[model samples]
Target: MTSKPLISVIVAVYNGAKTLQHCIDSVSNQTYLNKELIIIDGGSTDGTIEIIKSNQDKITYWESEPDNGIYHAWNKALGHASGDWICFLGSDDYLWKSSVFEEIIPHMIKAESQGTRMVYGQVARVTEDEEICCLDGDSWEYTWRGIIIDGIGSFAHQGMFHHRSIFELYGMFDVSFKIVGDYELLIRVFKEGGNAIFVNGLIVTGMQIGGITSNCVKLVNEMARARRKNRLRVITIPWLISYAWAICFPFLNYIIGERYVRYLVNFGKSSVTYLSYKKNVILEHKNDQ
Candidate 1:
């Protein structure tokens, strides 16, 4: 019988006392048996250390210290991870269910057989109250278009599983990118012809909203930098339009507030939906001829 592969779950946190326990519990509660948990704290002053101490028995290895950023902390954690597959979760993020790891194991096994290096699933963006906002993630087949056209990629890091060999091949995350280092690393993977598999109907993690990713302006700037760094074009129409909107979003939010901004977003989505429906109808008519 083949032994189940060991998986490592790594978390990096700073001043995350309020939510760190949930993150730890989610990993500890996983039904998968062959796994290890590692955590790196950024010298948090908010009782996060106490939480880590209490959960020491469940963690394989952990340390609390000041670090440069999430990527630096992640790079640090990578050294301690001794698993065939590695997954990263934010201090505020939690696995979607106890069966998440169990469910993903088969996919991981299949990926290994096929020489794929990455496997990812959907993530639910949730509010503090646990209300789900939406599912985030897409098929890798469609992911490249957005990465190339918008100068950004959309895979949720919390929901991704990286084969250990990927780091061995591609190196660790770039510590310089304060916001989009994960995206940059992912871009490097795809640019170098790394293969990925996306499992449908698998919701791996529940990500809390209003994290660093909510800073749209900084995210957009870093995304452009990442694209350039990876030798991807940064002058596409979608990229330009997103850059313009990101620059203006803060001012618009300041003047009109988030509610109105949400309204405008919904309106734009509606317009796009209508246009897409009309285009589909025209295509159908032409095809019928």
Candidate 2:
């Protein structure tokens, strides 16, 4: 691999004029220079095309046309990709810092030397007001185990980089999926013996509170479908209960408010996960005894 292999950053948009410029500007300001920005707009009429046109000099390739959802646009971007590695960026998300790729590329080169094909980093989940919601930093063990056992998300696309060959080997994003396609593809990656190096700092951040994927019920359903298709067994009871809670949580929030709802939900989740882990440990110890 070259000391500075070209990286293709693919940004997909749909009526995202409001946040598109910030996303493009973040890519343009990157300290790393051997990169290309590919933008695929799903026929946005909300001035998103104008944003793309204005930034053409910073972009390598782009198109605006009617297509499927995020994953389909992702597939289109993949088709046009011409870099050694590629990553998807949401139009509503931006690199956490201008030096993100500059810091990440060296690791990619090292990983290539060590025969690793994927690399991921921490993502600071933030809200529309730029307030941090949470930080994601799961390593391969945790991500692989969590998805296989719990059907939960252990990574986000914006914070991860993939060597172009992985896609050629594992196939492109499953366009039939709208929300959990990344999760599904990741399952295949892990199952096929693919691994990632976990970069130790914040790579990207974005609004955590909205978007089509933010609908907890739909996300849960899509994830369950993905898990089933991949033949990974996961307990359905807790997820079903969570789905019910998701349906009622909005109404409950309307009454009790966002802060209280968030507090209660977080407390419940932490307590349940803690108890589950404890029980599993006990069961394993008993079997050992």
Screening candidate 2 with a backbone cut-off below 3 angstroms (N, C-alpha, C), the clashing residue pairs are: none
What C-alpha root-mean-square deviation, in Å, does candidate 2 show against the real structure?
2.7
Cα lDDT computed for each candidate against the true fold: 0.82, 0.78
Candidate 1, residue 135: Cα displacement in angstroms equals: 0.8
For candidate 1, give the lDDT of residue 218: 87
In TM-score terms, which candidate is top? 2
Best by lDDT: 1
lDDT (tens digit, per residue) of candidate 1 on 1-289: 1358899999999999999999999999999889999999999999999999999999999998899999999999999999999999889999999999889899899999989888999988777888776776777755544554445444578889999998998899999999899989888888745568999899999987667866877888899899888888887655665567677778887898654553454344334334444665799899999
Steric clashes per prediction: 0, 0
TM-scores for every candidate against the unseen true structure: 0.87, 0.88
| True-structure lDDT of candidate 1 | 0.82
